[model samples]
Target chain A: MRKPKLSDEDYPTTGHEWDGIREYDKPMPRWWLWTFYATILFALVYVVFYPAIPLVNGATPGVLGWSTRADLAAEVEAVSLRNADIDQRLLDTPIGDLGADPDLTRYATAGGAAVFRTYCSQCHGAGAQGAKGYPNLQDDDWLWGGDLEAIVLTLKHGIRDDGDDDTRFSQMPAFGDILETGEIDALTQYVLSLSGQDHDADLAAAGPVLFEENCASCHGETGLGEREQGAPNLTDAIWLFGGDAETIGHTITFSRYGMMPAWNTRISEAQIKQVAFYVHQLGGGE
Target chain B: MTDQITEPPRLFEAREPVFPQRISGWYRRLKWRIMLGTLAIYYLTPWIRWDRGANLPDQAVLIDLAHARFYFFWIEIWPHEFYVVAGLLIMAGLGLFLFTAALGRVWCGYACPQTVWTDLFILVERWVEGDRNARIRLLRSPWTLRTARLRATKWTLWLLIALATGGAWVFYFADAPTLLADLVTFRAPFVAYATIGVLTATTFVFGGFLREQVCTYMCPWPRIQAAMMDEDSLTVAYRDWRGEPRGKKHENTSGDCIDCMACVNVCPQGIDIRDGQQVECITCALCIDACDTMMEKIGKPRGLIDYVALSDEPLERAGHPPRSIWSHVLRLRNFIYFGLWTGIGAMLVVALFIRSDFSLAVTPDRNPQFVKLSDGTIRNAYTLKINNQTGFARDFHISIKTDEPLRVDLEGTAELNVTVPPDGVLNTRVYIFAKPEFEANRAETTPVRFWVEERAEAGARTHADTVFTGDTQ
Candidate 1:
């Protein structure tokens, strides 16, 4: 054994030097060295017990023969087993009665959110806050209706969709050639005036008579827009195209029609119910 | 004269091994009992079966993370009731405070897992390689086949104990019998194996190797316990007033101390009781038992090293009798801590008993606000969520309370009786159609309460208050 009284100068040093400083080759701490070796042993054991080595076909099966896919399947199975009761109850309970039970409502809401994310989020933003032309599900403005049953019907048949016979179909006559340009301008001012927006008073006064004669049958005498006809409320701030005077004049002349695909063939009935339940709760659905 | 310069000692020194000498007395026996009791509870709790009807798990104490439920015998806690777990943790904290204020570090000395497991490892070491002197000699001796064999046997035993400790912990998270079978067959989850491996490594390193270093360096409790304690708190201390002026006993002229170092040898923390209280001292009182035995053998009074309050130390030095242990134990601070601890426990118990098994939550649809049906009646859509928390199936009658006549339609069905499965919820969309006359008289929003009553139980009912949205204008 080396003498304990040896000076630091006598200690072995690495050949490398920086400035005047020389590096001493001291041994690693005993506990740290042991811990490192222990981890290596643990890794070896782990490799033997779990899939580690890669092959042409796949990774090694390992001693335990476990796979991530199998684990995921088991987890998915466990969750489904847990939710089986709620799922059955949801299927049996009337869509209208779903809100009466808190647990079922929560389940439905969550299911609805998942469905919305998969199908509706592309058009209706992730939060169901709509983009232009796509109706915002979270606002108290609906072309058809905001009631649960009305929303469900809209989801099933959709508006002006091609494939479905029961699809909500409405056509506003394009008065571009039928009516004079001056009459269309007067109607725009009258439509703007209904919402109390700033407009030409003389034109609006002349516009109401034309509106009462032409628009009242569909848009309602009060300009509140008939839900049965899918006419948007002229008074509300929400507008699918644009609420400006020029946009209104163009819409009156050429006529505005928005098409939404029927979701009956795209998503399951349960999913439609779930999405309706979810959209209904987005601080919007009546 | 010139003084020779010498290098200063390194501030950080490698850990020195401790060889605590075996000493038997009340404290040691008490420590043994506590260690065995705690170990038994920890190992056997998961194995105890509970009968919670048909669908639930039968573990007496289980934290069912998979199901997001905590089952403790008869009490089944859902994820929403996690406040009960928080209350329990708070009670544990307050309990430690109460005990610490009354008796300093009684938990650390008698009940800490580190101390208990370290004591077990030490006992095993003593059995394999004799007591203190022999173990020290064996360590210092050059490696021989006999010494190597003894060391190997000791390590093997320590590893087994650690393995058992680790294996027992994972059983609490799963079904004990099934998991044990799966583990034996090497078919358990990889995480379970990993958990056991990690726990085994930690238990072995902490209990067998790091022992006292954990209490001194790793743990923060000793530092916090210092703040919890006061002068009146009872702690294992050396009665310096009686044993000071240390020397050989000569008649009544000198102090009774014989200058024996038995107290230091038997100390688990390797602290000298004569140096007053210290952070290193766990207050385990093994030194007291050693000192008492030595004093009795030498025909002197015991209690040379004993539990003494700092407040009593001055009194004893002034030739006055120390206050009784009860006088220190029943202080106002300790009383308050005890009261707070029990008060929370009582509140939790009350909440557990009074909470309803079912609940009704209604969310009225707001989009488009209210729809005007073709018949001119105003209809409001509501999503009702009925939570049935009971274990058995139940039939519920749904009803609504409105100021005026309202037609409630659930999927066009007029019947309000609903049957829900066990431990489930029934979700439904309700369209409440208010008569035009009713909407004309009521405001834009009317107060409506939705109620669900168990068909068999007279008073088992829950109700949610929601607005009856309408187009009043």
Candidate 2:
């Protein structure tokens, strides 16, 4: 090591001084200066290899041609490749027997939740509870059925979806086209009476006869509904749409035909199964 | 002395090397024992075995990062219970404060890892290069084959010690024996090697090269000691009142101090203690031993350089007896710190004993508060998270308590009993349905609580409260 340097008083000072006090003209540490230079060199190298500088059109595509979007795509592609076997296994297994492997059920349920959020939440709900025209999935009332196989079939080919030839096709004729206004009004009261809702008994007296003649084939004699025909059980507290007197009157007059898109066209077969697993575990699965 | 202080650049300066001469004294022996005890504990703690079930780790002290758990013998801390760790850290800080207020800079001198490791490194240096005089001679001399050989031998030993220091640390985070085999076979995780590499480099540099400079310029504790120390605090100081009028031991009118430079020569800090309470003094008491030995040789009383408080200096100058060490230690500041330290410790112990082996959390679905089902019944969906934070796989019977007749159903099973692996967290959906008769008269919001009870221990139960929204219009 060098001998101790000249005293602080003897050392050269910057011209700036306060009273008799003077600041020493000490240079920065050599390592610090070297590190600063290294950072500058790194920045220059980074500009050449990475998309750093922004232009009006977009960022400059450096020689490496790396982009964050491309990077994310690669990462997603890598994960997809890794889970190919798991996805295949989930698709191969029957939906009813998924719970035989609890671990695989868990994986399917978790991945299904992510898929539901991305693809199904818009129409049904984030919680899988359907909105106004859509069905409340958490209830025991299913348009067709609530079992795993039934739900999976419904998911593949949605209700009254025109695009899918094998979709759950059902249509209630508009009573205004076939029946008189007074007859339609009487049928509404009887339909409301079936669920034990408030109704005019005198007007509803003709409901059983009218229901038998027009709606019994699909809605059943007791108005319990036919799942094979996608007719909702009128006696249930849960309703796909509103269950008020006005809504019931309108349903009789105009009929209801709700539409849900076939998910098979939009999501993968494995994703469909995963979402079925997730929805099946949402406390309402049969 | 003030003028001798240099104004080095804020963070960097040319370090002055210190070659502390070899000495033997009561304090040096005590320091040696303490150093050995601390180092032994640090290196061997991971290897100690505690039977915490076969499924869990057997290491007495382990930080299971993968599982996010901290295990210390019989005690286990989940990540959620990190406040206990925080409380321990606060206790450690308070302990340093109490000791510093009572006896200044004692931690820096005796127990600081920097001090202990540097002492060990210096001991190695002495064995290879002789004591202070010989090391200085080698430093001043031109390069020689013997010097090269000795330097290589010394550095090789230092590096080995540093590697061991780092190797011991990695074991704390994993199963020690398993990790050790994996490490030697180069099959260990990348993080373990990275941690060992970083720690090895830091230990080698900080202990071998920096030495006393760490205490003097690098450590923030030395500066913070100003607030901790007071006039009553005992510090290593030269008794200038007795030692003044300094002259040669042969002189007729000389003070007790011989001006022999033994105190200065033996100082690990390379500072003269006679310079009236310098900050560099770690109060290690090596100088007191050196000066006392010289004093006895010169037919004078010991303690020419001694541990004395400034307040006692004036009384001692008037030829009064010094007060007891307890008188300084049992003051108000120390009492407050000690009280706080024990209070937190007591609270932690109470909390640890009172804590249950499991935890429960319930979150109801917000999107649809209630669902009206087919049977004129109202239903609510909830997600329950049950944490089985124990060493053994356990069964938990999950049930609900409410004023209304609410039927609870777990998704996967007919019954509510679930088996959770040791230290596992189970998340499942639960459906709560109101009785059909009570559906019409249900309240807007009914308060309900879900309880998770250990099957083996009936009293071991935890509960979380939530609301059940009305599905009836």
Candidate 3:
């Protein structure tokens, strides 16, 4: 051994001085050096056991062959298996009696809320509050029906869906080709007055007779609407298209055809049932 | 000092083994009692059980990290109520400070696990290898079969103690009986085994081998105590004035100290008490016991090595009476620390007792804010989490108290009645509908209170205030 120890003045330094300040170049502790070497060894071993190096196309597959994607898939599969019993229960439960089982009701509603946000929210609004032309699902008024079974049917076949043979289909002839401009104007005023909107009383005088002859078959004589025929109620403040006279005139001249795609073709049966259950419980189901 | 000495100091100083001579005195007996008392408390605490009904664990003291709860006898702390645990930690710290300022390192000398466990390890060592002189001689002697057998016996005993210490710690985190059964069957969690392994290694190395070095180098409490101490703080110190001017035994010249090394030999720290107060001294007062015994044998007075404040040194040297211990202990700083320590404990107790058995959190739906109904009624949806912390399943009736003619209803149930399980949280939705053209229906948002009342208790009720959104926005 050269020497046991050296005093501070004779200790080795980094050799770069600044303003009479010199840093000591002390040897690292044996334990600390060994820990550093162990860390490097661990990295090397980890690279061989896990995907570590990045390639142009993808990461290099290690011998163990584990991936985060596969891990996530396994977790999802595990959860699916865990809830298989509950999912079966939800499927077997009658749509109308769902409310009787609080557990299934909660499961359906919570699941339906997720399905709604993912698919139905774009058209019907996130809370099923509806946009301009779409029907407000949270209201008691329903063009088709608002009950659980009715909602399920609407979800399965949809309103005016062309692909589904059992789709709720209805059509009103565009009055612009059949009626005079003066008659259509009178009908517009009368339609607005039915909803208690401001209108010219004199122009609306011919509306009741004209509506009874032309619109009373699907729309009731009192204009309360026929749910079996899939017609809307006119007395309510909830308007699907618009309640203004201009929109009403346009509706009379060129009739409205709202299209809702059959959800059964798009989403799973459980998802369809859940979304229906979700809409029914939004304080609107009769 | 290094320049004057011909021999140079090594960069890495090799450790010299400490073999404290076995001695008995008032301090030694007190340490033994404290060690036994503390060890019994540690090893036996997990076996205590208290009933917490069907829904909760019955362990009297458990951290229950899986459930994010702390159960201690009658009180259970929820994750949100972690401030109570923080308050307890603060009280413990302040208590340490108060004791250090008054009596000096009482925690370190008598109560610290390191001190207690190391004392036990040393006792085992003494039994296996004889007393201090014999152990020193064995160290210098060449290895032999008998020596190997003694070493093996001592090490095996130390390992058993270390294993027990580690096993005791794991019991605090889980149910003791169930975990113990699982551990014996080798079905315990990997983390539990890993924790035991790590703790066992640390306890063995720290308590068995590096005993005084831990206090002198690793522990920060003794260094922090330097700031807490003053002239009036009672520390284990030597009255060098009376005992210095050293003379050989029976050839005593002028001082009481006969140059006997009884105080040093019996010291756990292996530090001479006559060298005055040092950081290495745990102030265990073992040296006082050893020196006092020697004094009686030689027909001299005891307390040559005694507990005294630095300020009392001058007064005692002049032959005047030393001040009372109360004068040294009851200072303004110590009283303030004690007041703070007790105040937090009192506040935590009050908080625990006054905590509600049921709680509510109402979150209004942010998706659509408000939905206008067919009859022009404005509706707002809310999700309420009702936490029933009690042991019984509870029925809570939901009602809205508002000036907006708002009607509250629970979805899927017309009666607005909800049953929450014991010690469970119920996540359910609520629908509030306002009358057509109500005053608040014209406004953007209206304030509303959701009252959830337990049906069992006539007056037990809680309310969560939230806003009912309207059509204006």
Candidate 4:
């Protein structure tokens, strides 16, 4: 091998000097130059093959014709295709029979939870904890019933809604207009006594006769509150509006009416079943 | 010493291109074996299948970024449990420190991917274009059709090796067989192709072309490794006490070196060992093999260039026996590093065994902290996330422990028992209603805890504490 001259005087200078040093004007390594060229070639080919350069009107559609939107659509399509079978099973299976298959149960419950968050969580809280007028779905106190079938029916027809003819409808007469104030006060004492709460014994004694005469048909003789009539049980500590003496007196005098919108016309059948199944699984569902 | 240090680069000086001659010895064989073992592990680990039950992936070692899970042979890591991975990285750092203190740059020489792949590329180059002399001749000669053909063949082989190197890396993130098929059919995801493309270009340029420059300049390990090595650390060194004052032949008249330049020709880094220790030396010990062969040819003692500790140089020059390599390797510094490395390893193992597969995390709703129900009851909402890390689906019963009379109510169903899918997270919206008395005597915020228990598995329980915001009294 020939030894390269290391002396500054022997080197071919580029006429650039600083601090008593001269530049040699040595060529870059051949392999390094070729690698640089190879990178440029690769970039040119990549530009031609992939969507890269932007034009005045729009981006250039390269040979590969890849678009981010199309890629996302394809990914979404693939996921749906994989889930198609489970979705179909959810639709075919009865909401009552959903608990029989664990896998299907899981799928429906997950889907139902999502559906509830979208639709049912407005009036009812996101956790299905009902507001003042709305029925708290988490409690054992169901205005209609708490069973899976009962929830399904309620979800379909709603309660006292004007749109649905089959909606559960009930109304208490405005006792303030019908009876004297003394009579409404006595009835509140009678209602409080049934729940085993503190009340005036003599007032309750006089209140039962009026309660037996006015509320026996739908509330039952024992005040268990018939599910068919959607009347809340007065014997339990739970109350739809309020269980206090004043509120009970006001409820009896002016009457209380709660309305729920039917979801059959609003949401799909699958979604209705899912939400019903979801609500039934809540701890309050019997 | 003055000859050892080069002055700052002159404006007119040209870089000396390194063209290392091939050599073989015990160290070379050891290097070849390590390269084969490391490369095999890298290329084949993702293909090894482990039956992870029905719903989970079967790859033995995988990083499932989509699911935020990492699976390694029997061990699985969740996103929240990334501390184990961090602990492992710390152990690796300590291990590097320990190994570097005992044996200088052994990791760089034997185990580093840059060293291993560069060696492989050089081997292929030698097989096609012949060894050092022939390659130098080819570089010096004028361009010819034969030389162009050889160059094309060498570059194509290098490209294929680089492609395979990159191809094996992507398999760790996905199912090996399925991704391989997808890649072959041009149906793989864009990220997969993009990753392979970037890695391919890097491997080709770094392994096939840059070679030793990666160790000397690009990598930070070599600099860190220099700090780890001490006077007692074993490194490839010339026995200059005997080999110096070189180039004479008569008995007792000259040193053993003979100024043959064999050591320089055989060095991958192309630095002269006679110039003393420099940061560029990787301690590959190939120069030792080369010098030993020359010594054997001249009927002189081998080991003119051999593994030696710097502290032993004075003793050996005074004609006293130097310390053994075992004595040099087993010192206080190495012992301390080993102790720290193993201490973390032991702690990690203990934590792994004690940790529960099921975990509960509660996030209380903040927007409307407390909602007053129709019956004059205050309700607080929380989003509960239950993580089931078991291989099979499990039923977890949710309950709460609080001093206040709080009723736990999950949104979906009346059932307290929730079936969490295998290796999945179940998010349930929960509403806790305070009793009438509790609501009447409310605090600004009440501390509450939500607990989860695996129904079938005893002792598998975890809980999360969250604040239940309520009306101030």
* lDDT (Cα, tens digit) per residue for candidate 1, span B1-473: 22332554342445666789999998899998999999999889999999876767888998888877788988878777799999999999999999999899999998999999999999999999999999989988899998999999999999999999999999989999999999999999998899999999999989989888789877999999999999989998988878877876664446777777789888778667887888878888899899999998988888999999999987899999889999999989999999999999999999999988888889887644565543346667788888777677889888899877788877457888888777667887787877667853346688898998989957598899998876654
DockQ values per model: 0.07, 0.38, 0.28, 0.06
In angstroms, give how far residue A70 of model 3 lies from its true place: 3.1
Error of 4 at B305 (Å): 3.8
Candidate 1 chain A: 10-residue stretch with minimal lDDT: A1-10
TM-score of 2: 0.89
How much of the true A–B contact set does each candidate keep?
A: 0.00, 0.49, 0.41, 0.02
TM-score for each of the candidates: 0.73, 0.89, 0.83, 0.71
Q: Under the 3 Å rule for N, CA and C atoms, how many clashes does model 4 have?
A: 8
lDDT of 2 by residue, B436-458 (tens): 68642367888898998888855
Docking class of 4: incorrect
Candidate 4 local lDDT, A131-202, one digit each (tens): 766777866677788898899889899998999988989887888998788888888999998988899888
Error of 4 at A184 (Å): 3.9
Minimal lDDT window, size 10, model 4 chain B: B1-10
Chain B structural similarity as TM-score, candidate 4: 0.94
1 or 2, which is superior by DockQ? 2
Model 3 earns a TM-score of 0.83
Report clash pairs, candidate 4.
Answer: A132-B374, A281-B413, A281-B414, A282-B412, A282-B413, A282-B414, A283-B413, A283-B414
| CA RMSD of each candidate after superposition | 9.1, 3.9, 4.9, 7.4
